[model samples]
Target chain A: MNDTPHIQLKGVKKRFGSKLVLDGVDLTIRRGESVVIIGGSGTGKSVTLKCVLGILRADEGSIHVAGEDVTRASGSKRDAYLRKFGMLFQGGALFDSLSIWENVAFGLIQGRGLPRKQARETAIEKLAMVGLSADIANLSPAELSGGMQKRVGLARAIAANPEILFFDEPTTGLDPIMADVINKLIASTVRDLGVTAVSITHDMVSARRISSRIAMLYKGRIIWDGPTDSIDNSGNPYVDQFIRGSAEGPIRMEVRS
Target chain B: MSANENILSSNWNIFAAIGRVVLAFLAGTGRLAVFAGIAISHIVRPPIYWQLVLHQMLRIGYFSLPVVGLTAFFTGAVLCLQIYIGGNRYGAEAFVPQIVVLGITRELGPVIAGLMMAGRVSAAIAAEIGTMRVTEQIDALTTLATNPFKYLVVPRIVAAVVTLPILVAVADSIGVFGGYIVGTRSLGFNGAVYINNTMNFVTAGDVRSGLIKASVFGFIIALMGCYSGFHSKGGAQGVGAATTQAVVSASILILAANYLMTSFFFSE
Candidate 1:
């Protein structure tokens, strides 16, 4: 395998007014690698992902996708860059107006100009990949359970066969069993497609299962990064505290009585 | 602090507050202008969604028939009655048909239909798009490599600009019919004379002007709706605010544009 990084972010910074969200972050993911960013609820994990997608522009530094500077790409260049990405938002974010299959086929039809019939076939194929059947294709997204919706979201994410897939808190609202199912699906999809995957989640089980490598974000930067097998013995107090889910640690979460 | 200093500081504070509001308004106007420019630019680009445009036309134009029709009809009836009653004092009651037709075609028909559509269409557009925004569906479109403006705003704008004129034509005719019903039935005039007087007195310019105003009103209504919804944040409360703002802003703009267009059209 040629060892070029599929994505690289160096000294990336983002802020909303006076709130410093992403403070000089740096990370890299090699092609075909599945990397999960583990972080607490307000640690700018999503902001980092958004900056890479150009949904939210970074205030400083650089982001490169396949050796092309994407941080400042605008208009057609930005659109072309975005075409390579498929994001599964936290809430599924399925187009509620469209049926399940239509939602899956959306990027294919709208973005790629595929024929409706071919797009429908591709949608069904993707849905099947996530363990959903063809019977549910015509139903609206609201008709699905949380787990099923996540499956549908996964199907949609992989619909266009994007080279890079992003999952924003893929397992946040699911039951443990459902979260595990989604984690497996994500893992299988990434492996089967041989695509680069970056996911943000607070779920440790999901992180360990879906990712080849894991990075823990704290204080607007990646505090720990290593192979998933080494996470337990990484000896970083913050990562240890987070994975252990103990209240007593160097990290103090705000709580009010 | 001394009383003089206190008074001076208080005066400065008041001016500062007023200045802030003025600046905010100007800033908002500038943002709206830029958004409008972006929307217009996307409108001329290729890959137009004709099906979506037709869908919007059905929703905004075709479905609005009943409300716009009834409003125009009633306004014409009332104008006929009022003009006749008021004109009777000056022995000018015979001028009812001419005046009612003039009023309906030149002003009442388009304005009433525009305001009614603003109330109906603007709120619907804002609520739908605002919900989409809150749910991150618009963001999803961007990630999917689809331009939300091209998919959402352009179709609605074009549909409104096209449909509003057709709707105004229907309203103008119904309004004229309403005036005829009142003029001949209750006012006790020969139907033929009423029709002939209206036909002779009403110029094509009057109808054309009203249609022009309706098209402009349509553009305003859809643009405000799309703009407000596109910027909505937070959640249900935010969508609610956007809906209300769309209606209010569209209605005001329609009236203001009416004034401006009427002045330019009839300046001579």
Candidate 2:
């Protein structure tokens, strides 16, 4: 409800060897704002998310969440800070060794220190919310189909009811129908939770379905940012080229034979 | 004019090659040592996963029994045969049982079992963890408020250290029995005398030394496996490389550690 920035990245820079991934990335998201970052395959959209999460430290500048500098926290303070976030990795990233219910309940039991029985109950409830039945709870993650695994990943991410949620390519590697289904679930989940949501995805349809605002990351900087509905008339050539899905534009594709 | 320069450059190239190789080896060693230190620091921390430790013990120790038993048996049989042939030259064939028991307990039992585990348990560990790494399961753990080192690494190290000594103890018995079988059945010696000679010649000190070495070898095997898996990158190929590295490094460390421990125990 508060209109202050919940997360802010000021001149954040990240470099992997000589390849500069995020070059002076500056972005701000207000509390409870659902923002989707879109870019080409290697434009460092994921790097920006990771920087805010403090998974990958920014080489230059600072990242602050809820007015607290991310890098300043350590030990239990850092742990407490991380507890506020729930992430859905692009790969689903479920623990293969654990049962599906256990995977869903992982953050609850491990992060929040919820008892296993309580966590399992929460896990089953969350799975049902994602339209998965409770019987599949005992099955291994590998047993589930790709779409089912993504649902399970969503269930796991929201099971802890984190204050902030991150979806990394939520609909990637799915059939169009399954991707649409996942988009609906993610849309409802974000609205229901009322959490600040940050997503990295190239799927414009999914982005439009889930995000309140859209930001285009190009060559490491946010070249365009506006309301989700206003993306079409943004006037930025890169944004126009990206939305139109055209190859013949300023954004050159390096085609390697 | 350029011939002298070419020869000098070639000479410099040889030294550079050696320097690079040596530096790579040192860097690898340093990384393993740092990983071991981090693992050790977690051991004293709270939230020790005893169930995971028990599970690893079953995997690393119980499942390795068959291969270790078979290897120990063959090794002891060969030792008896070789000792008999060598002793015959010096007219000391009667001492075969004593030397066989001594050798099995003090040297071969721990080293052989350690090598077997290096191939079996170490490779399995690296493959499993390396796959987890590539899949983001490890990063997922970080997000879920679990320490990967505490949850994944410490249990394995503990399981190995606790279980390996027990395995070597089993190996020593099977190995000595193997020597007994060959000495009495094939080498034309009385069974009772063979058992008596083995029991009289082998001391508690000999078995103790082997057990200590087994514990050290266990530490090395688990450390190498965990180290390789934790740092693995890429995908399936990375996991494969990690598995190979784990086995090779664990095997080499086991042998090197065996020699060092043997000398330390017996140097006086």
Candidate 3:
């Protein structure tokens, strides 16, 4: 095993104006490991991921990816760092104006300067891997169903064979069967590609199925971190309260914001 | 908690509120200026997406022909009719053709076309980009190693800068033809004499200045649209606000810029 973790965050703190979203977040993921951060709504899981991606800067703390300090990097250095990451946004976030194939081929053609024709071919192949046919390639993303859009998003994320993949609530806004299919696809994709993944989700079933390890976030801190199998017996009230989906537990819902 | 103290604090709060509003407005202006600077800097760089620029040109310029042409024609006809009626009182009715050509070529053509496009193109841009922002497509582009400014803003800016002048030229030709129609038919002037009067009286400088105004107006329209859209937050309401801001600001800036350019070009 490598001495240094593939992705590391130490005391990552971020605040938007008066509200502190991420307060002293610390975590590490080994190479080829899948870590899913589980939390309730507005728990700052997305903020942590965005901080690592350099989309949002942490007010305090250091984020290192592949031994490079991503927080301070700028310009082409930052762009080079970003090239290693592939993200599946919660909503798929596919460009509505572009055809499905063009969305998948976007990174290759734009970032890698690949020829459009070659990129399109590669995109079709990726779509096939995600169980989509080439016939739907020319259709705009708006024409597809939510589940299909998610599949296209997955295809796009893995199209470039990136080193690190970030899935932001991959199963969000989907039915149970479709969500399971997506989870299986994600698990297989990550396993086959052997890429490091950090996902944020509230879906416990998804966390258990897609990740080797689970970290539960509460009040802007990681309350517990351990292997997925050990999660059931972790003996943490918050984790138990969250996993069981119980209303009467140590975790109290603040109804009035 | 005393009544006098409460009144004093309320007055102080009002002053603070005013100060905050002014400060926020200034800060927004400063941020927009910086954004404009960065966008202009990228204009000279490689990886210029000519295909996207061409598509935007077709969207912003080619599709705008009918509306711009119609507006210019009507405006020119009205200006000729009004000048003929008004100039008759001063026994200078023959000046209609010259002034109508000058008005269409120099001022009314560019300004009207600018305001029209500001309403049409700017709002659409702001709405589209705003929706993209809210949906995280902009962030998705970033993760793919694509700079949103280079991919989105640059192409639109280039297209506007290139196409607005062309649109203005089209409007100018149509506007002159409109004036010619009114002059020969309604005013009973000889068609050949009207054409000769227009050709001989309007200088090349007038057309050049109008085109210059159109280009600057183009830059303003696209810049506002992209700026508002990029900064948009929340959801559909934010997109709506961005669209309104884009059109309103672009129109105001176009008129203001026209004033500056007009004074610079035609001032004594």
Candidate 4:
């Protein structure tokens, strides 16, 4: 394994109009590590992920992936940069107009121009990898349940065999049992693929299960970052408040503002 | 601090307000023009989704024909009756066939069909693309290495530009037939004479001009639709707002462009 970090962000700042969403977020992750970013609602967690992916550019920062600067990359450079990433969107974000297998095979056929037949076969294989059966291949995304949709989304993410994977609130809005199922699948996928994984979620149970290392984002900065086992004994008030799911302490919930 | 200075300041405020409004309008026009330029450029570029373009043609062009035809037919019939009513005072009722055919072929066919297609197709594009935008499907497309402008935008634009002229051609025939029906049946005119006058007076110049207007109107409709939807935010209300704006802007631009084109084509 290379000792250098696979991804690095330095002094990233992002603002939406007058509101400063990400003040100055800096984080780094080595190759083949699953880093889950835990944060409260409206804490700019998704924005951080988006900035890293170049979906939303940072106002001030430097982001490097595999030693290549991609802060303002566009055109073919951006496309090539994106080819290394596979994202499972918070809402699955599956193309509603396409069928299940077609949704899974979308990046392949549309982006890579692979033959539909070959793409469908790989799509089904990916679906099976995510514990989905072959029967649901013909069904539309809307026909599937929320959990099933997320599984399909995961299948799509891994279909291309990307070196990096991003999960935006992967287990959000799922029952505990189903969430656990997804969490286990994600853990195994990251382990087996040996790919770097970055996820954002408020679900501590999920964050704890899926990540080897955990980073807590507060006010657009990583406030607490450590190995998953040490999260409880981190001795930080914010970390304690967040992990315990408490509304008290130094962490204040903005209610009725 | 002084009375004269206060009055001057208040007057300056009005001037500033006017300047701000004008500047905003100019900025908006510039942005829309740039978006349209990019969409046009994308049309001639590689990686054009020909399949999606054909699909959009069916949706925007073929699906919109019935409404366009129905509106044109009624517009032509009404124009004939109105012209007959007005021409009766001047003893020019015999000119109804020539006037109706010319009006339908040159103005009402393209304008009415353009407006109808704007309402039907522009709103649909805005709603569909707006939903995709709000749902992060557009971002997903980016992550998947697909260009949203090419996949979601260019197809609708190409389909609209290519199909609207064909639609207007068909609508022109239907509108003339409508005038013929009302003229021969309702206005007590001889069928053979009405057909003869209509055929003789309607030149290729008139029909070609209208088809040209239809193509221009098509570009406006798709541009407004794609532009509004591409920038849509704030979820359901945003999508709703975009759909409304697409239809309104497309309709207004169609009419405005019709005036400009008409002046250019017939100012002589």
Candidate 5:
């Protein structure tokens, strides 16, 4: 894997009407590095990821994916750029109408236009990588448990063996054991595939386990960025309050009745 | 303190609110237009998902047939009975076959089937996608380099457009048969005469027009469901609202479009 940054964002800003979701965000992900973004709920962690993916166009600034300017790339060019990244959604986002193997092979069959039989075989292979049995490939996503669904989602994300992987709260709804398992799987998969990974999570343990570097997002800006081992002693107040899960901190939840 | 003045003021306020709502709706519709254009562009490009399209065709089109069929059958029967009663008083009982054929083939079958599908398919699409949106599945698709429009919306629209016409065709045939069954069995008409008269009075134009309407209605239903669900906000409440809006909007559009198409096809 190359040592240069695979994904880079500079001065990216996104606003929804009067409320700014991502305000002048800047970040960089080195090739084959796992960077987990940590933030409170509604702190623009997801927005940051979206900006990078070009799902939500930045109001201002630049996004470079694999050294190509993506902020302004539209249509096929953006789509071509997108093929290099894999994302695991928070809820797995499996098509309920499709079986497990079909869901896993969605990118392979639909996005890549592979033959059904070949796609099914590839889907089963990916599923096996996520520790799922081939027997479960015929089942609908609705038939699976939450953890299984996440595994299927993981299988789907890596099906294409993308250069960059994005995980949006992958461990959110899973049990502690499942979350840890996912974290380990993510860690090992990143290592094995040598793919650049970016994840956003409120779970500090997950962030620590899956990430080589951690970034704390606050007020739509990344307040601190450092290696996983240096997070505890980052000496940044916002990072300190967030990692400790303190109610009294620079971050306050918005409450309305 | 006058009643007329109070009523006038209330009406004025209502109109003003309605004006504001109309403007907002137009603005939102404009945004949807742009989104739809983006979605369409994705449809023609590479990375087409034929399997997803087939899957959606089965889900949105094939699964919806029974309800559309049942609704059309009942509607045709009732229309025939009402026409029979009215024609009997006027000594115009011979008109029963003609009116029933026209009613089912030109208006009833497509509109009724479309409305039923709007209720069933639109709500299903909205609820499924809205839930996914609230839970961040859509976002996940984005990260996976999967265009949600291509992966989610395009297949649905295509399936609906393709399947709705077939369903409407089946419903139209079944509905006319229903009127025939009722006209002959209950209204004491000669079975052969009813069938022959129905056939002779009904032109290919009527059936074709109904199927055309069905195609348009299908697109409208799927589009509304997808648009509402894709843009759904809030959480559970937002998703619920999206589902309700999708069904209601699709149904109303089907009716409105039916009237417009009817006038266009048959107006003097």
Candidate 6:
């Protein structure tokens, strides 16, 4: 892994009208490092990811990928820059109108303009990497089970062999066994591809399994960031409360009638 | 405050909520315009999604042919019946073919077909994309280094703009044929005269104008659907609302734009 960071964000601030989502956030992920962000719902973890992807523009801040300032980049330069990253959305986000292989090859065929036959072969290979069979590639996403869908999503994410990968709540809706399987797949794939990964998840087990380092987000800022081994001993009360899944801690759930 | 004052305050609150909705809607429109501009800039750039565009054209345009064809045909038939009844009162029954041909070619065919497409295609686009939004698929698209506008919006818009005129042209011709069928079979008119009158009286400009309207309406319909869908919120309720709003907004805009185009084309 390179000593230089692959993805970096500094003084990143974003707000939706009066509601501040990410407040002057700053973070960095080293090349080939797998970092998982842990946070409660609506704590701006997803917002942070969106800001980095340029899906939601930051109100103020700088986002850099591979040392290039992406904050002001536009058109083809930005698009070309984006080709380095891959993402697995929380819901798998597969197009229902497309078959599994087609979804996997969507970027390869559409974004990269690879021929259909070549893209399909590449898609099948990626699907196989994610433990999905070639037969499954012909089916629609709606036909797959939740776990299978996530696997297909993973396949799609890695289709182009991007240098950076982002997984948002990868294990949110899966059963424990399925979540563990996904976690292991993510870990092995990250290692095999030597790709830098940034993931956001509420599942402590998932965070523990897939990350080289973990960051806990609270009140729109990262309260704790360190190696995965140091997470349990970080002595941060917020991290403690979150990892323990305790109700009676520094984090309070909002209750409404 | 009295009871009447309380009622007035509640009404004011409603207005305030409405104002918020309006502001949000305007903001969404601005964002969509920006998104569209960005997508257009991406069109000629590398990493183009030609396959996706082709697939979308097949889906949005080719798949829409049957519906557009049927709508134009029925509209033409009904128009003929109405003109025949109205013209007969003044002993102008012979004018039915010309009137039907002109109306279908100049106004009714494109507008009505556009409205139908707005309801079908716009709602479908909105629902499909709105569901994707609620599910975080659009964000995923971004992470995949895929421009959602190119992957989602551009193709639909391109397909609609390219195909709707063709559909309108087909509808226009089929509609005129429908009038012929009705004028000859049901209305007891001279078939040859009706066909000749339709061919002669309906100038090429009228047909061209309707096709132009179709192209514009296609853009409006697809854009509204994509814009609403891309900005949907509140999960399922939001998706439903986006779909409804897309259809309604597309329909209204089609009519309004049609009036503007008509005035532009035929103004003295």
What overall lDDT goes with each candidate model?
0.93, 0.91, 0.93, 0.92, 0.87, 0.88
The 10-residue segment of model 4 chain B with minimum total lDDT is B60-69
Tens-place lDDT per residue, model 5, A1-257, is 46556998998888998998888889988887999999989889988888888878899999988777889887678778888988888888887767999888878865776898999999999998989999998999989999999999889989988988889998998999999999999999999999999999999999999999999888888889999999999999889988898889776778775
After superposition, candidate 1 runs with Cα above 4 Å error: A254-257
Backbone clash pairs in model 1 (N, Cα, C under 3 Å; residues 3+ apart or in different chains), count? 0
State the lDDT of candidate 5 residue by residue for B1-268, as single tens digits.
6999999999999999999999999998797788778767776775666777899889877888788878888888898999988988999988998998899888888988998999999999999889888877777666555678888888888888888889989998889888888888888889999989988888999899998998999888888889989989989999999999999888988999999999999897
Backbone clashes counted, model 3 = 0
lDDT tens digits, residue span B103-167, model 6: 99899889988998999999999999999999887876776656787778888887788878988
Ordered by lDDT, highest first, the candidates read 3, 1, 4, 2, 6, 5
**Two-chain complex of model 6, DockQ on C-alpha atoms against the true structure:** 0.67
Error of 6 at B143 (Å): 2.6
Clashing pairs in 5: none
lDDT of 3 by residue, B143-174 (tens): 99999999999999999988999999999989
| TM per candidate | 0.96, 0.95, 0.96, 0.96, 0.89, 0.90
DockQ-sorted candidate list, best first: 3, 1, 4, 2, 6, 5
Against the hidden true structure, what lDDT does model 6 obtain?
A: 0.88
Classified by CAPRI criteria, candidate 6 counts as medium
Point out where model 4 deviates above 4 Å: B1-27
The digit string of per-residue lDDT tens for model 2 on A83-158 reads 8888999999999999999999988877777899989999999999999999999999999999999999988888
lDDT of 2 by residue, B1-268 (tens): 6999999999999999999999999998898888898899899878788999999999999999999999999999999999999999999999999999889999999999999999998999999999999898888887787778978999999999999999999999999889888988999999988888889888999999999999999999898898899889899999999999999989988988888888899999
In order of listing, the candidates' clash counts read 0, 0, 0, 0, 0, 1
lDDT of 1 by residue, A1-257 (tens): 34768999999999997999998999999998999999898999989998998888999999999888999998889989888899998889999989999999999999989999999999999999999999999999999999999889889989998999999999888998888888888998899999999999998989999999999889899899999999999899999999999998999897787
Name the lDDT value of residue A163 in candidate 3: 92
